[model samples]
Target: MRGWRNALMLSLLPVLVSGGLSAAGGPDYPITPVPFTKVRASDGFWAPRLETNRKVTLPANFQKCAETGRISNFAKAAGKMEGKHEGIFFNDSDVFKVAEGAAYTLALSPDPELDAYLDNLIALFAGAQEEDGYLYTARTIDPSRPAPGAGKERWADIKNAHELYNMGHMIEAAVAHHQATGKRQFLDVAVKCADLIDRVFGPGKKYAATGHPELELALAKLYRCTGEKRYLDLAKFFVDQRGNAEHRELYGLYYQDHEPFLQQREAVGHAVRAGYFYSGAADVAALTGNPAYIDAIDRIWENAVTRRMYLTGGIGSKREGEAFGADYELPNATAYCETCAAIANAFWNHRMFLLHGDAKYMDVFERTVYNGYLAGVSLEGDTFFYPNPLSSDGIFPFNHGEPKRSPWFGCSCCPTNVVRFFPSLPGCAYATEKDRIYVGLYFGGTAEVALDGGAVIIAQETRYPWDGAVRLTVTPEHAGEFELRLRIPGWAQGSPVPGDLYTYADPSPAVITL
Candidate 1:
């Protein structure tokens, strides 16, 4: 009842809280991102891709799920089908990620067939859930004969086990589905599962954190979706528990739990995991105005940008553990920059910009969007790359022993993550403060922005990243005196990146016309 969005939801709440919540008022950053739903992209660059993801990629991913047995896992768990659990413990996450992408597609364009498909899928998910609201197909398919990484009990294996990780994707997909369709079926399941998690672990309860950092951000989303303070509290609790040995034994640096979050000044461990944790911390920092969360992510962001990041805006240098290498140790062909890590990096930088209203964050974000994660998906949208490297020999194993992109992989996180990420673009194009509208991203589009005034229509025309010429036409609802903050990219300023790690060779004066 509480989660369904109205026509003015974009005006009411802000955008891309998918990565971080942009809560208004208080000591929180005054700028709020405009939700993609309010901004439509007319630019041919992203339009074709969004349409391709919806038409080609969505059903293709769904077919792959069916063939791979991910779809049937739910049916098997629910007793609707008879079989043992199939695939890896984390396979459920891929399914959820695709579903979240599908929800985003539905928001932009109404698709009855896709809508019905999601509804039926949600039904299977509902059936797969346990009586008390526990949901995990690998275990629920047969509790007595659990799968390899399903854990001894529900919350037993926090390290390699992906129970919380899977549920985190589920919660995120559920929020997207609810926002798109205004149906509570999927959201109800997420709430039930979250409730079970809430009961199992917390302040006086288990005091655990995921070996992977996703549910923390997902919990922030759940809080925003349902307006339940408990979900936000749980998100903060999970972050608070990290590095607190008295609460739980730390998983060490590979999991970014080696030290107290506030004490951590460097970005360490698995790249994707670190990005999500910092993004969640930004969400908490924005919503709660907790300076601790702010300081931790701020420090971590600097350490990453100035040292560990790649020219492509990628991270994670070593294939071993698929983790980050030492600072400034970014290799060439052997680099293991996972596509998911790039997505996480972009997500983190977007949050940082929203938190600080700085163009540097968006600059790094643009580099990732253009060069980093965009390389993960081929033009066809069917093939994908798990590890996006800087250089590759024709015969070398760049992405897990494959030189070129593969149609699919044994671990399909990157493909599914790509599906979920592409549709989040419209929200990134614009943002708002009290009396100002920040054009954070450039694309030819029309955005119906909600100010303290009624609605303002801004039309942007440009062949961006390809052409520098931009034309903006602003029509405010009333003749209000609001400022427009146009972002001047670091690249235009002659710095390829914000930090000293990279720069441009051919420098020229940037031209801007009013």
Candidate 2:
């Protein structure tokens, strides 16, 4: 197994290493995110996490996958090992997510050893794929013993099988790896997998959407990667197919299937699902400039920040389905702020900002970073808190029905999420428009921002989050007039946020400005 991958990497290293495919043009939104590669975050808060994720978290996540049987499942399915699939069916997603994190780490700083490791894993993944690009190990390992929800027939239960969900993560991981390493080895496998999915489901095909709302984002990424129209169409199909009971029963709101996605206004059902769904909708909106899609997510985002979100920017109050409860359903002692939900919230808000160039979106993103999402992982980066409850009494089992922080979980999404998220901090620090650049989040860093005006270098020094003072130094390639927008935190501006969902009071007066 190892020898073949070692040979594979050597064979392809010379031929396929052109940075990556240029993004295909579309009706893209006005705001463009400055890639993390362009921003160098040197802050005490964020820089350490980036370094720690590379040095500790990424390797630890892969180690946990080895221990928990996630990596082995791929081996077993590839016929390189002798064993039944291990852990939950969704376990494959953990490995894919970890791989995605590793790709991000490699982008920051290349590690040949880590790169080779991913090559081996991708070989296992490639071997496990069937002739037609069917790649779920739970079913591929032994069809007769498919995971409980994975019905005997492939995709028999689209609502619970998580077949597409697993593929979504894999595709995203592959795109990240291809972009980071300039290797087409992993990208080939991902293209096969996505192509198979595209053939299996679509307008005239199955017309069914996955229970989980993830493939929406993956297909969008794939579309941008390869400049393929089918992937984009398939992504739109899934978004449009939900709640359409013309051919099958809806999975209901628990899966964001209660009504056609465009018709839905208020955020409802599962929080993580809703978060991913909202982000995917934004992607489609940005790509096609579909007014209905844009208007829909606008209302949905309003509902999320105004009614459903926690003060910490964590979302989903109900533990029953790991979902959002009614408006103002928050209960401090019983809060179920799943770490994955917070990560999804950050992802969604970032996409929202890209869609509208609104500072409010990053305001929420910053809050989640500092509070809800930050609490998910410990400072050392090994232990994890699955839930972010406001207060813990020590007896209520507040943290996802476990202690506040555990080294690992059976459903290891949170830890793996932390691995992928913190490495992306530099991406959140800056964005660009035609003749202007925007500072989305304040971090002491130097960014080489490429804009329509020209290449500009912005340097900043600040304690920010820890202290309020910030100073910036900007230099343009040539003397020119351009706009620079700095996002002012709602709290600092005295509004806290747009709606009356939160407030602040103090006896002592302090002056603040945007």
Candidate 3:
């Protein structure tokens, strides 16, 4: 009977191809095109409503928290710096010092309202910036601002003061805002900052190495958004600078400054930092098509997905380092699935999928989004989860009974991150390549795609995961042969047999002979 089934399957192949498979196509399903003007203006699984709402609300809440001097109180209580290096909150602003988390949030959203807030915040930081673009509130000046005291006189704080992370986040915000809004104010801020970063960190530059690994990716992304070769070179400089020993390296900071990214064999340091660097590496790989860079990414992915990952697809081994632990060392009790780390993981996975066109990467993305990320917000979308744990009983005392969502946190990275990422979901569902359009993920929406022949409106309608049924309808303006490739999720393999049918909108479903 099995032999007969195989023989019958082989025989039906020709007929099936000749018949021209009927697929669901139309404009009902849509995707937010890349280089958007407003975050969450379009909707889909890549971004959902609940998430977008959070993104839009966070900065305002933080600003309110800042203006009322409530933020200062929180900073003092949490041991974070409440002084003048202050612009926006960076995680636990008191304990972690005036750093970059909030600035990073600005990159993710860049909406007009948010942009204005960021402008004010940037002005605050600008007063703190060292004539050049070097800005780190924690290490550069005392708490009061305008020369009460110098920041981090020991050189330890500024050298390791998350200066680069702040700039990187600002760069990201600038690029995203420019793409979404067609405005240059944010981009101009980023460019000025980038020029400062180049002067300070590029070849023969003076800033030493980045204590945090973000600006590299941000520079790469900026390059992609604009056709600026200088941005690309700056990004390359950052990537090449990693892991080098000869540099005026800062010790006992985050990661070792003894080598470069290509030289580093394993993942290390803060989970978010490691993940961000890996993401930057993937961007370089996609842009340059460098096999060595791709090889590094493959190794990093193997290390991350196979060993350092949680069941929820979250990465990081210990709360102590917020870093990588050994293989299979994933413990549920102390799992520090930092909300920012999970968000970074999603960023890496998205870029990897785009670079390789692999569905498995998307699978990881789905896992991270549904489990690791969903835990970041409350059901009402008002609260946030910082350390997403697998089990939250008495054993996991730290995160137990913590509010699902809150108006704010001592370290406010997660809240703002959740808000901005939610609105950008639709842009991730599909990508176009000349004449061939790839349907990466299924979500109900419409996309206007410019193909080789002409523009075609693709409408997709489906309630995925909730239901297996999917329908896609394509309406073309002119007659052309356009290939629409659908994704066959790996999980669908070895499923039960079912009767499925798909229909198309165009009459006279044309037939062709090869």
Q: Candidate 1: RMSD over Cα atoms?
A: 5.4
Quantify all predictions' global Cα lDDT against the true fold: 0.85, 0.83, 0.58
Q: Estimate, for each residue in 167-279, the C-alpha lDDT of model 2 and write its tens digit.
A: 99999999999999899988888899999998889877887977898999998999999899888888888888878899888999889899988899889988888888888
Candidate 3 lDDT over 302-378, as tens digits, reads 67776678867687768887777776678887888888788889888877766665556766776687788878876
Across residues 1-514, which tens digit of lDDT does each residue of candidate 1 receive? Answer: 1111122223343332223333322234456778888988888787788778877777888889999999999999989999899999989999999999999989989989989999999999999999999888989999988899888777789788888899999999999999998999999999999999899889888888778899998998888777788888898888887788996688999999998887989999999999898888888888788778888899889989999999999999888878888889899888888999999999899988878777899888999989888899988899899998788778886766679988888889999999989887779888877756788788888999898876889999999868988788988888756667777777776788877898667766366444
Q: How far is each candidate from the true structure, as Cα RMSD in Å?
A: 5.4, 9.2, 10.2
Using alpha carbons, what is the TM-score of model 3? 0.75
Candidate 3 Cα misplacement greater than 4 A, ranges: 1-56, 63-131, 137-159, 250-259, 394-397, 400-405, 494-514
lDDT of 3: 0.58
> Model 1: how far is 151 from its true place, Å?
1.4
TM-score of each prediction? 0.94, 0.94, 0.75
Off by over 4 Å in 2: 1-22, 506-510
- In terms of TM-score, how similar is model 1 to the real structure? 0.94
The alpha-carbon lDDT assigned to residue 162 of candidate 1 equals 88
Residue 188 miss distance in model 3 (angstroms): 1.9
In candidate 1, which residue ranges exceed 4 Å CA deviation?
A: 1-29, 506-509
